[model samples]
Target: MSEQGFKYSILASGSSGNCFYLESPEKKILVDAGLSGKKITSLLAEIDRKPEDLDAIFVTHEHKDHIHGVGVLARKYHLDIYANQETWQAMEGHLGKLDLDQKHIFQMGKTKTFGDLDIESFGVSHDAVAPQFYRFMKDNKSFVILTDTGYVSDRMAGIVENADAYLIESNHDIEILRSGAYPWSLKQRILSDLGHLSNEDGAETMIRTLGNRTKKIYLGHLSKENNIKELAHMTMVNQLAQADLAVGHDFKVYDTSPDQATPLTNI
Candidate 1:
């Protein structure tokens, strides 16, 4: 990867599971490990990386699809795992045994430095106990990973604004979800403030958060049943057009997948 900026890839992203690989000049890390250990291992190989190459695993929440393989990877690779105190408490049972030094607790809304990168976690409106999203900075470039939140509050937007790249969730099409096969209670939950962002919600967030510094946007954590890549991309395109922004020229948008990894991108 280029030494000028950060290199990253979405290993897998969807309701089934989500994992992201990020490499700085001095550190290689996994933002989440939601897939099986075997699956995550294979995905890392696709990017010419191995589990042992990772310096740490920073978890966003305790959701199964976001943490299924965290324990396994940490144990197998002897990698450090970092999360907020409440998230540690909620996910401890799922992680099994670990050396005392393997676990690192960080406070919310605080920036922690590892090597050349600075990472900050802030609260998000999600059902999981103390769920949060992350913003990572390396020198002048910044990247934000915002997902699993039903709505983006002004505070959250302010925190993540002007990032060079974003991996934000454009989870579902509201109409399709509203009229789909899911039960009413489930639909209600998905649409609630503590759930996931709809396509429209995601677009609005981009409009508010994108700035002169923003360039690449990855729409992730899509719903397999209620969303398709084309539809989600179109929604973002249309909404962004209304703001006088051109998709390919103003900024590039990439759709992430659950079954595969995006090419390693530099920002």
Candidate 2:
């Protein structure tokens, strides 16, 4: 289906919660189920999909913001939940006793196939016990989603470079984070190697990894209180332009709003 159309939807993205739907006629997967069960169901309805339409739900980490609704969604929909072994362990408390029939655990650095989609998991620098990111492929089209990573590593870049569409985190502007109302301890955590990616760092990664095949870039996991969508867009646009890529005219750069369903679009 290389010549066939494939679609991906943000559904929702932000600090409050994050979830995405990726589909081809042969596969339908949800990257995460962070929002409430009702909210997730509503968002799926907006896209004309039902919870049962999902083939699997892949979790990036055990952060509450990313897995808040996982257990409920899984219990209600009985969807297969995929995660690295370590992540599954760390989240055992929240997940309680997962139904083996619906729990599909894999090790990091391994590739798993679901229908027409092939997914590869890679370790990312984040504070979670076993944080990871995902690279998804179907019909020769590839997309990488790496939110919550503190920084981009050489190995991580190798995985991201192959993606035609990259959805990476641009969590905050350093200036705002430094001067924001967050306390000293919290501030240090955000700036740490195991914290979150800064806006400038995210742009630098884009400048280095983006090639002609890259058509869309989504800045995800933004801080509602510390960062502005315009600022995040401008930061990436300016950096990419220096590399000779225009913003909207050359490619799409979308801000995943803090609490709204972004319409699904073809990559």
Candidate 3:
């Protein structure tokens, strides 16, 4: 990790929980506190970082798997918590009482600069109150974190069109999801435009997202019941192959696991 780069680790990402550790030389932040405070803190410690070291925590939405640890972590570290007003309101009953002063709201589509980073939030397709994805930029390099969206809009894609690295949701395979044991309504929901992205949907999104500037793109939010890592990986890779984009030579793709932090990614 050089002093000039931006770095990140997917602390945890899946249906169960979602958290990330990101930093530059002078500033550090966490995106979503979806796990237990203890678990997130422990993951930070693994990277030689502490909850107290973070400048802020950005909540993507009000879902339990996205804000479960926000209140606890905010109280523990006295950190700034960023979310839209509606999302903050939706999050309140679930996250317990948070200190009023700790809350900060950023307008969607506006770039907000925090310490050494510039972050822009854009609305994403999801069945939650004001769910969004973020683009983090510094030193002319950018890494985007986008998950839990059923589909990506062209506007949202334009916001993160030039990422150096991206962590995107590859939630399920259509066949597996359709034929699996989930209830019919649940299956329909997953297949809906506002639910979650299938492996094919995620892959098609990647094809549009891949550019000369892109280096690494991580496939995240795989469903344990409806998706396997190998299958999810092959599905996306095969799509790129059809597009004549070589994986290793053009860019890299890796699956993110719910139980472990992905390796440190520097951009």
Residue-level lDDT of model 3, residues 1-267, one tens digit each, is 576768899999888999988989878899998899999988887777788878889888988888889989888888888998889778888877778899898877778989888898999988998898799988889888888888888887778786899888899988988889999999988888779988888888888887899888899888889999999899888998898888878798887878688777678
- Candidate 2 Cα lDDT to native: 0.83
Off by over 4 Å in 3: none
What does the lDDT come to for candidate 1?
0.93
lDDT of each: 0.93, 0.83, 0.86
The TM-score-based order of candidates, best leading, equals 1, 3, 2
Supply the TM-score for candidate 3.
0.97
TM-score of candidate 2 on Cα atoms, chains taken together: 0.95
- Give the per-residue Cα lDDT of candidate 3 at 265: 68
Best by lDDT: 1
lDDT of 2 at 181: 96
Error of 2 at 146 (Å): 1.2
Which is the winner by lDDT between candidate 2 and candidate 3? Answer: 3
The TM-scores, one per candidate, come to: 0.98, 0.95, 0.97
The Cα error of candidate 3 at residue 204, in Å, is: 0.4
The list of candidate 1 runs beyond 4 A from truth reads: none
What's the C-alpha lDDT at position 121 in model 1? 89
